[model samples]
Target: MNWSSAEIGVLAHAVSRAPSVHDTKPWSLEPRGDVVELFERFDVSLPRHDPTGRDRVISCGAALANLELAVRALGWDAQTALFPQPGRGDLVAQVRASGRAAVTELTSARYSAIFRRHSHREPFRLRRVPVRRLRALTGAASEPGVQARLIDPRTETAPLADLLEYAAEVLKDDRAYQRELTAWLSLPPGAAERTSLPWAGLVRRGTRVPDRITFASRLAQEGLLVVLTPDDTRRDHLHAGAAAQRIWLDAVAGGLVASVVTQPLHLPEVRAGLIEQLGLAGYPQLILRVGYPAEAVPEPVKLPVVQEEAR
Candidate 1:
């Protein structure tokens, strides 16, 4: 079970492919003698969308899941310790690969999707995802202790849309929020070079801006609106990240594309508002926009893993 620097590099590379909100790969990897630890790297300068760093932790959790799977695929058994230390908030997870465990067929299949999946924000093909496939997605979300509610009723849809629009308007008017968004948005020509949100992923400037109403309307018109909820705790947020990654991988397996929006849900008011307006029972974690995309691409670049000195 001895792991060399080269082996660690390969595993770390695989971990970097996990998805994140706004492509903010907010994590640092530390390699011990035989373990890879993921630490949350917060960017305080950014505005309030992620005030509590829930999304950042979720992003790191997803990376941890990927790291485990990748290590297993490399014929090693990955033992994970989530939130290993109390009071020390930055350490998200520690994974150590040892012995030998063959990767399951399911893991092998999902591994390919890991590299191919990307957040697609563009319009999707006009088609409905089959009920069985939708169920599979729901199961994927539930696996990590999150609930995925698929909004199918027109009445429920209308209210959710309205709430989203209200939240969007609030964000649009907040200069600080706009400035933060602008900082992350990868402009037209240099998007690929930047590690931030790519302009290609954004709706055109003249296009109807994304609001709750607009988002729901678009989902009704071209895709499906899946509301992912959690039990409303910091640990729940971490589970939501794991669920989000699973669902995204399932979508890839089902020949579908997906995108996520947490901006609206970031505000406490918006989260409560959506719960009341939509008459939902659980806390909304993310709004997943899903449909068949025209193309799929590899995930954005991530910082190389810098192994910290052992304690």
Candidate 2:
């Protein structure tokens, strides 16, 4: 588990690229002896959109996956201990390097994809994803306690579209929600990032349409899926997050892009509607939009990801 300074930096860089709820990288890494510790930066917790810190913990879990993948791709086996101590919610996980193994092409490809994964708002290409590739995406959630399923776009389109609109109506009048949402948003006709980077808005505004109806309508033409679990405990939430990162990484390896939408599920009614409409046998933890990018993605689009050094 003794890691060189350079290896630690590579691991940190991989974790930094993980997707968070609002580009808020809510995790940090520390090298302790032979183990690399991943901790949750709860200070960035979103009260309006994520009341229970579920998304925050989930975000950390995504980073955890990336950390492990980076280690493996570098030819080291990563042995992880999740939630190593009871009642210590701040400690997301601890990972230590084990004996070296030959790095497989698959691992290298997935690791390379970590740097290229992104979210796009534009409609995907007209070509539908091959069934084999779609299945591989869901298979990434192979870790215990997680299950992923692709919703039948042909059957669930109308109701899925309605749920987006319903959730919009449900939260429209809440000023707190609006304020926090605006705080994270960097785009619109006149909106810009807090840092005054005008072009930053263009990247942040991916797939985020002004009208919910239009957003839902456009979504119908793309890939839609969910990651779910049989339980709703904290551990399950973490598992869901790990599954999400795996799916995203796999999508990237297959020349696809994705975005996540979990705000609407925060409302119980919306979650229930999803369960009833989709006939889910478990709790849905994340909703994902997957597709081939319709237009070229800008290189600067990924520069604004907010990450912090270990505290």
Candidate 3:
């Protein structure tokens, strides 16, 4: 089947629904003949939280996965090429329509979740996710090259909580870091409007701040998982993104909610520390907090897919 503008538009809309860090949709798409090429927009990088820009790429990778799945939902096989060239830093993935293919029931089910999944920051309900359901989430990470492990031990949990407390304290004390966070945080209720983080989504500053704000709260209430890769490379990061979206969509299928934490894992020292403290043997790409949310919000806004000619 030949690709058309309407099909490309639907695929683009599905891609925009993928989860991103701090609602930063760090990607762009260009329709090249019959293929949709995805590029990582580095300008959307959160310099403070992601200095290395690894999370930015991972977010884009997740977007690429969504694009691929969207293509499949349209009865087409998506041929994807990751980081096609060495010098082109922004290029993430190229998805071309190969031919007509049957979209599996699982894929169709997950497609619904693609647009339904949202990064929830509010507190979760008292209901604990079933162990089997949690395992299904782990299974979602069973891609070509990725590993997802749920952190359940008290010994591992304690230190992770400590590290998060320390990181939060440090961030609070560091003026520059605070300024950067403030810039991202949304304005107060009924206050002046600004281009910042959505205040409604943020944990309030007072004692009422949700547990998601503090690692301890996350540890106590939610089911936490550590996303890891055997090797620390660009390809591994991309794989992690694929694994993350898979898990996210799986959670949606199971009526679960998830939120990702990269702030603590941003620092190399913190990453290593968490590994040592948790006695884990691989590089931690993201810390996923999952559970049934108490409240659900609308999907985050995303930039429209803009097609541009190759330079």
Each model's lDDT: 0.68, 0.75, 0.72
lDDT of 3 by residue, 58-94 (tens): 8887897789888887777889898887889788788
lDDT tens digits by residue: candidate 1, 37-62: 88888653345567777777778767
Once superposed on the true structure, which residue ranges of model 3 sit more than 4 Å away at CA?
187-218, 295-311
**Candidate 2 lDDT for residue 130:** 66
Order of candidate numbers by lDDT, starting with the best: 2, 3, 1
Best by lDDT: 2
Q: Name the 10 consecutive residues with the lowest summed lDDT in model 3.
A: 195-204
Clash count, candidate 3: 1
The TM-scores of all predictions, comma-separated, are 0.83, 0.85, 0.84
- RMSD versus native structure for model 1: 5.6
Per-residue alpha-carbon lDDT of model 2 for 24-142, expressed as tens digits? Answer: 99888899866899988878867988999888878887898888888887677889999998887789799988777777776776787788887654456877776567777898997
